[model samples]
Target: MVSSSPQTLILSRILTQNEAQPEAEAVLVEAGRVVAVGRREDMQAQFPKADTLDHRDLILTPGLCDAHIHLVAYGFSLTQLQLYGARSVAEIAARVGQRAANTPIGTWIQGGGFLMSELGLNDYPTAEMLDSVSLHHPVLLYSRDLHLAWANSLALRLAGVNENTPDPLSGRIVRPLGTLLENAAELVARAVPAPSGAQTLAAARAGANDLAARGYVSAHTMAYEGPEAPRALQTLAAQGELPLRIWACLPHQRLPEAAELLKTNSELFEFGGLKFFADGALGSRTAWLHPPGFADGSGTGIALDSPELIAALGREALELGLVPVTHAIGDRANTEVLNVYDGLRALARQKGLRLRVEHAQHLRPGDIPRFAGLTVSAQPIHLQGDAAMIGALLPQHQRTSYAFKSFKAAGALLAFGSDAPVARPDVRASFAAAVTRVADNGVRLAPNEALSVEETLWAFTRGPALAAGWTDEGMIQAGARAAFTLWDQVGHQARALVF
Candidate 1:
């Protein structure tokens, strides 16, 4: 038996993503990169001095990568109250009351993971519901989609959000003064005290370590939080506390600042993309749809960050050697983004950069082929929750929803992720959602869109690596990173195996 060491010959049923050698029996790793991959006996004989890690009974695949996540924000949500399964507003308020009973009277309380439809609510909830329980404490809870926020009276007052306050462009202050949608949520979010630098660092560590614990070797963090978020992750990496290799993005609005770090890279972190949102999410009733809007009579949803802005800033992002990543959830939004990307593609190709679209959730059939040569960073886990909503809210678009197989057929580079904090980064959840197209409500959203297990695995691994431009990751080949995921069963129990 060989003892564990930095250099080891690991044996397993290797699913090498390299086209030349799709499978291998063994791999030789030194430092943190693969030195060679070949048959078990040949590798063992060649590297007799190298320690051996025998996992011949397990399956070894390229390292898993979450292509979209809000790392620091998700970390903070881990400690906050989780409102994932609540079926009623009263239940949510009770949970808040219990937390208030133990906390300081004036502290702000935060939580998320509730769907408007899941609660069986016919209308936007009122602040009075939360006010009844924690009158003194400011309570602010976000909808599962992160596009809608419900604030208690105190919190709304703190943010100076009143019934008469005009809604910010592309946002809504839902009447009766309790819910904030889209950018409007930021009004109250600003009032909540910021976590201290130490707390931020702790959260960064928590998120990164949590992903590592779940067998993820790397992640692409979306720019949903403040600059402090990425800074915290960088600091954690600098201190040797970060567990996952991170590809972080900055908001397109932060491109001027992003330009300074154009060529940033290190062992564990790199600034890779500029993120822009073309529209909001479905659960929040804010997906910018085409002519036929929400069936619930909620007119065509809000559009954020105009196409002009995306084109201008997106070109600028590409010039600075950054990927232009846009979040587009509706057909119209996707169409518009695709149109803008048409002009930017030439520049992106010249720079060896791939334009990326996040949450290309609902797309028109005509626009599907336009994704060729682009990265579609998506979260199938979201389908579990959005399934019923899609059927009820936008039935006309169901056929094209979560079109994973179609994306592959169209030559789009499909990458899977959990969009953590929006949903848990459970690999099985992603695998099941992609492979089955089944939703939690016992109904399949779009059966035709289901992906095969191998395709799903590719999305979770190599697809993300390609999107992030990480040539050395997401494959088991000489010169590739030695990070891998060992599985008892492909979609079952798994763990990170890094040399």
Candidate 2:
């Protein structure tokens, strides 16, 4: 016999999604992998001395995963002065002044979670208002998307930006208020001292722990910060302190260094995915769009990396056996990325790497089929608040806003997430938004596009696993990772159960 004694776990309902629907089956596990799965009697007789967890009333499914999230940034965001609910510019200034008063002079003060549309100011905020709060302290408040940044006059001075300062390529400094958009934000952010190593580690831990508490067993962390963020996660993994399984990406800017590191540390964490940005976010009105972009006439949003650049990088990444994930929210952005991906489909298939598009939030109905064989990493929670902005700003694209059902029906891999630091990664909220299709004002945006409970569950589990290329997880069957989630009800609360 392979072994005299084997470990067994029997649940009242084991949701093996491999079939037409979730089926109640018995799952046998040993040595951190599933040994067999069939009936309760069959498994019990096979492992007489094995301990069994009696979860007869709970629904057991694969552990949930977040497809797109910023782990370290979210962790530090948890500890900062939260301004997520500030209603007005005055309210935001008051809060910043209060935080500045307590901190020592010359120390950097950071806070985020403000929406440009909600601030009451039609245009971007200037540095003078922040200066009025505290000229001695350097203030940097990022818009919820991290694309737009509001800085104080003192911070601007330190960054060496002035009235005559020309805009950097793919970035702009909004006149009147010293706000930096996209790459422009880096000019000032780069000059600031980096967070201490210990601070970075603590932030990573905090972020990962918070996700675990919310029942997420793994996450595909998108690279948004410096290399140090991923380094902190590696340290946690080596120390056995990593709470959630992490698959991280590196920005195209650092691909050279990352490619060299892969020579020795390939298995430490898979290094075969490159992240690219096709455009900025909608909240900042920087999303590249087709003609007559925004109803407010903000001009057809800004484009970041061009299609040629993405295609060139896509080829480079493919040569290294890496997947290419581009961020495209607007209709034009999506069309361009799809074109670039079409050119590389053969190469991607040869490399066995699946390309991904983050935030396929708005799309032209005609292009829905383009997503077939690709991953759509999306955050449904954004639709709840963004519905109103869509109507007011991009009225033309409002009908297709956050088209979740359309993507799924088109054979695309739909992996859902919260886009934390922008919205709460609350599983309850995400489930509700996906299934209900209701906006903040109780108006249903695309009610016909609502997903079923089972479909939503797959997105939270198997879809993300497939997107991240982790076949060992996200399923409940023989030889799968012994990680699962127990739900009180199909669409209700959840808790992780790792063997």
Candidate 3:
């Protein structure tokens, strides 16, 4: 067991990332912060009676940090019905039936993790198939990307969604089984009652604990859920229940309210990022792209929020000391975001905010360097699952998809994370994907884009720390956080240890 006592400990082969090679060292922890790191002999002579734990064969490095993730939602989804491996619509229906039989009548049956392509249904599944089993309970199952949702007849009727219902702005209504895309899904989601404060807090705690178990010492939770999520995290922090440090963002729609919240409380948890969506994802064929969009002629793709809106809000956010983070998945989306970022570069520099782009997956070669001085918060693990989609829908993007090496060369700050509730936040898997560049199809997306193990570690640690504007964490050195992650080796095993 590790001691909490403000004592000195000598470790073997401490990796200072600042140094080229590992060093035989000692670390002094006091008040949960690293006080000193020096030669083992010097530390022993300086504090002979201080408690010491030697990690002879273990590598001592900074704790891992996830740059982007959804906290409470991911946790709640963990216990929900899983449809990740369902091969066909029949399989999905069977699972829904099983869940419905046990559930009380008239309640909404919610579960996720289905890919529309894998369902064997070219057309969306209507509520008829679900109504065939049990019309008593409403069902709303989300696609893997969460950009699209499939609802049963009961759920649609309850939500007042019909063939005559108009699609919400920046959203789509798939004909037949009432599939709502993007903001349209929120309509039905809004009708559902919000979770209680207790439930929200519990889910947040569960999510944090789960991430900690997976070797994460901290995270930058992208605010996609309502205000309740960050409030829940603050509650945990106040009670000393939070095991990891949290840096949270707020959606642009809630900017005014968030500004008021920040005016009163800025240090409760690091609150300094504004989240925006530049476009939808590829799964739903909503990602904005260049000419010759989607090999299947999905019609040039869908654009969500305009770059002008992001830039306008970004300027305001900077005035309040908040960084701007936008989601950009397609080549067009990335291009537009880069244009907006270019407009804010000077302002970002003035405010000391590193403008960030989430999921800058697909990119044009010429626009790559425009990301310099910006934080590229990306998911490498997404490549493993997205390989097929890239081949089918985005053949032009395959060369630059998830281009970690290219981004590094362009001087972009690379931060890696798993968009949990979208992809499992497995640190080992993320590292493997970044370092190996191998995909699910057993083919490499771009061998030139592979990152080194150390580079991957830095992205998971220091890169995210810098992106989130955190100075006291993400490093193993004096004045750094006492949090640390132990790994047997890259892609092997890991666990988080918070002092």
lDDT of 3 by residue, 208-284 (tens): 88998998888889998888899999888888888888888899988887667786443437687899998888887
TM-score of each: 0.98, 0.95, 0.96
Better of 1 and 2 by TM-score: 1
Report residue 259 deviation for candidate 3 (angstroms): 2.8
**In model 1, where do residues sit more than 4 Å from their true spots?**
1-6
Q: State, as a TM-score between 0 and 1, how close model 1 is to the true structure.
A: 0.98
Per-residue lDDT for 180-251 in model 1, tens only? Answer: 999999999999998899998888889888998999999999987887898898888888777788998988
The local distance difference test score of each candidate is 0.91, 0.84, 0.83
Weakest ten-residue segment in model 1 by summed lDDT: 1-10
How does residue 29 of candidate 1 score in lDDT? 88
Which is the leading candidate under TM-score? 1
Alpha-carbon shift of residue 173 in model 2 (angstroms): 0.5
lDDT of 3 at 136: 84
Clashes of each: 0, 1, 1
